[model samples]
Target: MLTAHTAEGELVILTRSQSLESLRERRKQESFYCPQCKEQLILKVGDLVIPHFAHYQQSSCRNSFSEGESPAHLLGKSQLYEFFSHHTPAVKLEPFLPDIQQRPDLLVVWGDTEVPVEFQCSTISTSLVRQRNAGYYLLNMLPVWIILTPQSIQTSTADILTLRLSSFLQFFIRQIPNRMSVLLTYHPQSERFYYLSPIIHLQGSTYAARHLTLSLHKQTVPFSLPSSPSQTDIRELALHYQSARRKYLRTVIAYNQKGIHNQFLRACYEMRIQPVQLPAWIGVPVQGQEAFRQSDCEWQLLFVAAVRETRKSPDQLNTSFFHTFIKQFDGEPDDLLAACRSYGDFLREERIDIYRMDRFTDGDFVYEVLSGRFLAMYAKN
Candidate 1:
């Protein structure tokens, strides 16, 4: 808590220029209170910690601030407050909004919008994320979350920009309208921002992304998304996607269970095909791959097997059947349907017969689907 109210109901902000001796003297004369809870506060002008107001240990205020706030969180919040203050006159440090019963680290007015900037330096749950966003949306205020950079970020290859997104971190990902999805993070120590933009989910947690770093000094009030990847960059990413798909095939052969109880393996067995020996077209990367938590190969193989069991020809392939088939597997309905439809459309367009699986064994065809056709589909003209 950085702001407080004096006995005279005057607001006192610690960030403003005020002598410590004068504050200590004032502490002796009058009592300061919390702006949100209206409870009495203790002003701590310590040598180690930053000068700020803290509530009493036994205070029953529901709007209690600074209980679990770490030193990093405090430092980042203060730095962001100063940074946003420079850009707009309507910047506030930890403003408690009674309407939502939420206190954002910083709130800045951008044009006619009130943006709540959350400097999250700790782990958060998905429900909590949804709740906070819902609260902000309820008030017609857009919320921006800048997470503290993790200690390590794993990359798939040194040549291309890639990231392994854990389920927890995936909660931070946001998709702007008519733009790509991105995750924004900040390092308070370096005072730099790491923007993971145009994230393409290869399979499961593996994603092909572009990382952009920007110093706080160069940042603006409304942050900007990085430019789209160039042709060469997208080509490299496509190669990475190909590598991941190859690795998935290898992993399925080596690590996954092959028993009759194993769903994907059972389907492969019934189709008289080895899991690794499946056609390259079955597991090729497509848009909306993020909907599945498992490797796209698993569900995609099952889908092809189901189609083969029906003995459907190119013209006889029913999209409604494909949608219902994908619905049995867990995922976002629209996205799952889109991915299945893309694969089904490719089969029909190529006039490939699902029953006669022996016709399409071109391993290089996967690259064509990913690099040529898939990339062209997403490419901005």
Candidate 2:
């Protein structure tokens, strides 16, 4: 189902099950936005569309604007495109063909055949890699694979070497083909690209962000230990940061509540920190009267369904029934409050069981939960 990782609610879309009425209710219930790309995404409640995310913009982003209008890659693929455009023939970037399954990043019409320039950064599923290559081949397009690296990885000591570690390691691991057209490595600072080998070694993929981090550190940290980021790591980082920001913004804009969501996003953007996953709300179901181990009033309000008010409802909310129940609980309603308290206490105690169960990797963000916790999603105005 199209749901948040925390499982509170999901925007599931499947054409076979839900009717129009149910779909309408969900629209009224909640809204969703893309976690990555910071775009508004639609989540259909009914079964008309499968429970999957679709980008709002249909066009393929030849560049994700990571460099953000940095004038394309210098010794990068765009440089290669510019060179080809000048020398060869009609150079069309992101070409579409009848036989080709999807659009390619670049295509050059050379003689009777079309040469496809596929420049990929970061890593994707191995299956997707093969599909892209095979698709170009099927359309009778000569595939020129260009795997570009960040602009900071090149070093003076490694310059004279016949083969560098990043290229060589991928070769040793059987990642790239020996007969590739071009293998270009660029440095953002110098805006220079080094032609490593005529026979390119297509090694595994690395995350652009992490690679940038390692490269920047190489000034002191020494990057390129023959490494690539796993697809899961890259994808989650991409998804969560985008999702978290939007969720935080929505919470802030709608409620203008100063503390939790606002502070969270401000910290991330200001520090440029990326959260691994967006805040998720776990499901909580109350046990029946007989199900309680001890139902007596000895513990009383400690475990009572009706508890003391948290924030005195701001005038209007105080009188509203909806706000009445909400104000009563310091954290979440139903089973969620105890979950947050227990989870918060567990985090402060530095327990591993919480990490494994909650799947929180970043200790900083998770620990922040101990402070206020998004104890409650938000009460509607």
> lDDT per prediction?
0.74, 0.36
Write candidate 2's Cα lDDT for 201-259 as tens digits. Answer: 11123211222222322321111232232444334333433343344335444543444
- Runs off by more than 4 Å, candidate 1: 16-31, 45-49, 154-163, 177-179, 255-260, 313-316, 349-352, 359-362, 365-381
Each candidate's clash count: 0, 14
Candidate 2 lDDT (Cα, 0 to 1):
0.36
Q: What's model 1's lDDT at 364?
A: 53
lDDT over C-alpha atoms for residue 20 of model 1: 71
Report the lDDT of model 1 for residue 267. 76
Model 1 root-mean-square deviation: 3.6
Best by lDDT: 1
